[model samples]
Target chain A: MSSTPTALPDPMTLREVYQQQQPYTRMTPLLVSESLSKLIHGDVLVKAESLQKTGAFKFRGAIYRLLLLTPEQKQQGVTAYSSGNFARGLAAAGKILNVKVTLVMPADAPENKIASAKKLGANVVLCQQMEPSREEAAQKLSEDIANQNGSILLHPFDDPEIIKGQSAVGVELMQQLQQQQINCQSLLCPVGGGSLVAGCSLLFDPFHTSTQVFGVEPEGYAGMNQSLLVNHLSRAPGKNLSHCDALLARSPGKANFEVVRQTSVKGLRVSEHFVVEAVQIAFEELKLVLEPSGAIALGALMQYPAQFRGQTVVAIATGGNVDKALFTELVNK
Target chain B: MSSTPTALPDPMTLREVYQQQQPYTRMTPLLVSESLSKLIHGDVLVKAESLQKTGAFKFRGAIYRLLLLTPEQKQQGVTAYSSGNFARGLAAAGKILNVKVTLVMPADAPENKIASAKKLGANVVLCQQMEPSREEAAQKLSEDIANQNGSILLHPFDDPEIIKGQSAVGVELMQQLQQQQINCQSLLCPVGGGSLVAGCSLLFDPFHTSTQVFGVEPEGYAGMNQSLLVNHLSRAPGKNLSHCDALLARSPGKANFEVVRQTSVKGLRVSEHFVVEAVQIAFEELKLVLEPSGAIALGALMQYPAQFRGQTVVAIATGGNVDKALFTELVNK
Candidate 1:
């Protein structure tokens, strides 16, 4: 169900959002991975958003969304639903901006994520219903809460303003690449509901540069890839279990899909094994902790090396919020 | 034994070395740890040298050492002995500079460290002797190799030039602190033969600023602390075992001790349990993978929070090159 194509934000708008968020956001290092480069026979630079505030890129969007709120809306507070990363990010942003945040998170969300959100002073409601899906159940509860309180309801990745805020990753990457004199041939982003890829693709599109943008997803949850192929909204099979808990969304958001469609963003799906291997590699070689969801894009590059051989590529590591037990099991295994 | 006080390098000299090494080294992020800050009722900033080339701050010293070599010396190559981090860093630096590096590492050194040194194209010779100590045995072997081959022998931490090279961390940190406008009252550095602490103390000393510097060591291997207390070079008891394999040196280097003494740096010791807990805390809160040696500074902060209460402090995370099994056990435990 596609509406009229939404216009991409102008370059000026992207810069304005980035400048506003600069003070709060960390300029995460763009680290060159010599080991990964040798494996692919090309340059592989990882933008470590895993080191970002709240341990994820989701903080950028969350903070920007709160900044866009009216003075009255700020006073009224906001509500949102997240599996983990977004919940913690929003809670942290709310703490920084002195706004109250209410989060509805799945009961099975990683314990650390839940604890961190509550630690940041967010009122968290545990959603136990997994009938349709955990995400949908939590989303419904958050909406109900917002309706009752008359506070703003923010989507994790579907809103245009959130997309604009996430585009700051691209803005920062471009500046870093320029400083390093790197001519990037491909840019890879881990996609769940596709906000990160959609926003990054818009900035690194044909109109702006010749960089081929890719949205990488786990094999079973490849809705973004499927939707891009058909040029329409689609659902993932969701038939297989995966360790990438943060990236199990069944479908891409309509707003995100529309943006990726217009920007000609490509998609790739990686196996669970490769995602775990990527996480381990990040630990051993790059000395960075990456959640499985965050390492997925790097896994895609490893899974399909021929496509990027002899070219400079950038992979956006989305988050680092996995539980200790899961991370230990994956890395040790 | 104590030697004449070593003159500290002038700021201009430190700047020159930093400028020369900046292109090859990563300007790792200076992350403000909100959790740590809240715990101590003060701000705590972590300089993540764990993200440095070769996954440790040793790479900064290694590269700088190689750069300072004369053409003839570079052609003849160099030899050194280390337990792990220094070996890996020197090997990687040799690969970059096209110099032949021969390393003598303890046979019991971490498997990943030995493998990485070999992978980086160094001629690695494992020393099985642990009579006096693993480090001493390896050092003797390295010296013999250098004598036979007519190659220059390098002291991993005792050399004045190498300490100067490691001072780049201080130069970079000072600039970052200024940018963030943080008036750091205390600086903590992990000590292995005291090179890092000595280098940093020279920069943050009373002659330059009022910052109090501390060298953090494992309780059993607190050689730097013992040496500083008696105002003479002394040896650690070496009676207790520790997981901080990279920081088991029984004594601070004479050159390093002299520098620290001249700078009036203090020392702190953390127990093995606290070191292990610090590793887990770094993983969970900072989203950084730190080897026990690298995490010792953070451990010092946690162990003696009262010492730094209500003060802006900086802790240097020195490395992240532990084997997967060890890291898993530590983080999971």
Candidate 2:
């Protein structure tokens, strides 16, 4: 391993990125609930990315990444692998920017997601997740497409550009908190591929030094937490076993984990049952539709209230791209 | 009844109400969807007032009405006879402004809504709706409270201030349409007491005559449509009821119905099945959690595509305050 650190992207530059990109992206409200504040024994502000375009914060990074592409890159088009929120975000961004997007999903990825991607004008390629040679199959598909069509892979979290783009979220949060005159003592966000958390860490690092950042993970896929402890990205807990497949990243990004380790942040693992309960609360009380992964922050708040009391906390409700059928199942149950 | 026409409130002065009340009231997104456009066979824009504070467009009127109250009036407190969204909105706005709110809900009203009002610091007064005498009971309660506490009666839809306040939605739609550069041919909204439709009509009448303003009503409670045709708010359809209890008004506001009748726009009477299906679609596709009334515009579009095709149309998603248990029941069914 190299002893020297890679040049970390400048937080100021990310702020600039936010300024430039805000017209295209939404400045989602950071609303504090007097009722919720009293419930948790703290002032709680919700950074409602639930209202973000494509119903998640992924659109922010996806828009920035697509916007920054060169004329040649734009012509060559972009590729991303996900059957989830990011894929939808990329597809929507691609459609708006008039760029072509090719998304690769496991064959069993929710039909709704596939339909949504297609609706947004993406060429969807589906491969079975259960096949013995699936991982190899996906890799070969990516390489063969890249070779033939000169496409660029828009990795969900690992790319430096994507991380820098995601950092815009933190920049917005800091500015919004200040504008609202809210003194946030802590920030909580669900950790999936660490793109959103990494961006937040970078943005929160330069200001509010005492503000602790926390990432929440569904129990079966605490890769980011494990990786931060070991000082490297590590494998996901099990082979495609987590119900929160969005959070089932095989490893955290090296740069992302490094930022998390350096940012005075901690990770909390929430049980799947708690995630479902949080989702129910959000749907029933908050009148917000949150996917299981999207509800992880709420799960942490619900499951562990003592750790967060008296602190002005902000929770990043990452996305609302649950399969509608899954929501019916959860809510109905 | 007064023989003279009810004077329309001035829109210019209404701008001040919007400025004062909009901070607490959400200017919920006016989203244009391609999928809904395809389904409706025209461009479809949704003014998602369902996402408003207190989960409905009712907040706009309630907050504005509260702002207009004199210091003496505020000190005396306010009261309303509502078993639905208005109760929650009034309670929430009152909590923010330190005004006392007394809500009279039917004992049979959804438990969740009653709980929400209580949780938001409202004085909850319940009356039984099971008997024919319940209306007289409500009137007596209102009179008793008014005499005892000097409380102002906050009628849900009939008040001039309330109607004018809700007109801000029309103003917002106009502004957003300009910003989005969309020339809508028609506006569709759900009609319960006719306040939302009246407000919208005020905008479309002299301001944007080219744009027709339509209202959707549940077949179970199409009193506004009936009132428009008969030239009087009536209760003939009161026997035909709705599980969408928020929309079960027996009569339209006389003043508001007068305006709704003058519009060139038509009404669409849709079934409960379409409303349920539309709510499902809103949750599933648009990532919006709308109450049954909120989903009716979409329902109308889904049921009567031929009437809306080839024109730019905007739908008012009236509210998003469905009870969780009821939501579960509806989604499950």
Which portions of model 1 show Cα errors greater than 4 Å? A1-3, B1-3
What i-RMS does each candidate reach, in Å? 0.7, 2.6
TM-score of each: 0.98, 0.88
- Give the top-scoring candidate (DockQ): 1
TM-score of chain B of 1: 0.98
Candidate 1 structure lDDT = 0.91
lDDT per residue (tens digit) for residues A1-333 in model 1: 645876778767898999999999999999988877988899999999999999999999999999999899999999999989999999999999999999999999999899999999999999999868787888999999999988889999999998998999999998899898899989999998888988898789976798999999999999999988887898888888888888989899888988998888998999998998999899988888899999998898889989899989999999999899888888887
Backbone collision tally, model 1: 0
Candidate 2 residues lying further than 4 Å off, grouped into runs, are A1-3, A15-27, A33-35, A70-77, A96-100, A119-121, A129-141, A144-150, A207-211, A239-242, A261-264, B67-77, B130-151, B171-183, B208-210, B258-266
Provide DockQ values for all models, in the order shown.
0.88, 0.41
